[model samples]
Target: MKQWKLGLVVVLGISGLFSGRAIAAEEIILRYGILERTVAVSDLSQLAETGEATSQLQSYFDTAEVPAEEVQNMLNSDVTVDGVNINRILDNPLGDVLLDEVSKSIYPESGSAGRQAMRAALVLSAVDDDRITVIEVLENYPTSRVVLDTERLAETYEDFQEVGGVVVTVEDTLDDVLNVIRILETLSN
Candidate 1:
């Protein structure tokens, strides 16, 4: 009888974790080029969380100018045990292009999912310069600090350097909001 009771409790606990409204609302803002857009941060339960979404999200990070290995770990990670999502900040036209491409690629599987990711990416673009300058991609990383030394990642550097841009990542685990701002700061002196 004791074993039965314990089993029931475990089952109930597991079910409770899975059973919940899929729609999660969050407050966030993104700026791309000179346009700033405000949007609610939430995950669509209807979409059903899947590895494909994780893979797609990773693709953006993979193609980025930063270290591929580090980026991969970050995107495919659920660092926060509390169910909080990490935020990534990518700077410049490349960042904008990445979001656009992501939206286009994911349109068939899920329009809403693509839009949400793009919207999130756009929120990070705090500048509307139209020209590709600096691209800072900051993510809300988990407690575990992952060192992605940009200097070490040469192949990736070659890919991004062709376009002339750099991505700086900042990790803030506690913050519920993953906000990133890419500013042109100054023109070539």
Candidate 2:
């Protein structure tokens, strides 16, 4: 009787472990730009947990065939990473409007892809016209957030004299950027 009980307990434990993994591996739609990516949520969580700086989530973004230079520039900018003070730039009326506009554009009234796009666009729109002259939003990590320095990117291009509204379908706003980071931190926990 004791042996049977022990065997049953072991089997249950193994089953529970597999079940947990399956749950983690469940497919989830990650939105960035005008794109909806169906991938394993567990994979994103794993990338976040490992503290891998590289956007392992890029594979999903690639489906949209976004320009490589644009993506690279956005990643290299300040908004892409964490621990940057964007409070001053984002705390303005224009900044707020920019975020709202992007939100509406990407989310629209329906469609999962549209909603995801809007979510991504919100952050893309926040790029400070002064700092980030140009921008490119790549991926959305449910566990980790990325911000685009649109203001800075604009500066690099001579044609873009004024930074605002230069990068279409990108969310580079300040508050939006911070909010996404907050979400990432929450997911990480």
Candidate 3:
């Protein structure tokens, strides 16, 4: 009788373990740009809580195929105004956007200075743009909350000149870049 009880207990414990993994496999909705995707809840939770989750998201952005030539040129080149790196002038707030616009250009097809031109265009567009500013970032278990400074972002862009001569480095992985953009977009909305 004692042996039978022990065996039943072991079987139940094993079954519970498998069922727990099944529960974790449940799906959740995640939005990227205009696309909505159904991903495993476990995957989303891991991404929210762990820094290691970046590798998975990075693979998703690699599909854009920003040309190797453009990436190389931008990495080697410096953006300087009066011999100071443009990034030094901006002090980092707009660094991500500047880098993304320049490094991700499709190259030769876009023209000899397409990357630089694209970077310029992005800076110009941000002038009249009204995206919200992030105020607070919060993570609560499976849910995350981000508060924005809507009023400030609604004001006209007066800081464009600060980012005008910015230089970008492709030091970050493509996935990391995309992750930042997604997070910024999420907060802005």
RMSD of each: 19.1, 17.0, 23.0
TM-score, cand. 2: 0.27
Q: What digit string (tens of lDDT, one per residue) describes model 2 on residues 31-55?
A: 5555555544344344434523235
What tens digits encode model 3's per-residue C-alpha lDDT throughout 24-106?
11443333345434444344345444423344444433443333333223222222232112223233546545443333321
Overlapping backbone residue pairs in candidate 2 total 30
| Per-candidate clashes, comma-separated | 19, 30, 1
After superposition of all CA atoms, the RMSD between model 1 and the true structure is 19.1
**In model 3, which range of ten residues has the least summed lDDT?**
132-141
Error of 1 at 59 (Å): 23
| Segments in model 3 whose C-alpha atoms lie over 4 Å from true places | 1-25, 54-56, 61-189
lDDT of 1 by residue, 1-189 (tens): 345434533543354347441211232232223433332222111112232223433343344433434433433322111111111333345555644543342221223444343333233222222122112222211101112222333333344344222332222422323322222223322
Candidate 1, residue 58: how far the Cα is off, in Å:
20
**Ten residues in a row with the worst lDDT in model 1?**
78-87
Higher-TM-score candidate of 1 and 2: 2
Clash list (residue pairs), candidate 3: 58-175
Score candidate 3 by TM-score against the native: 0.19
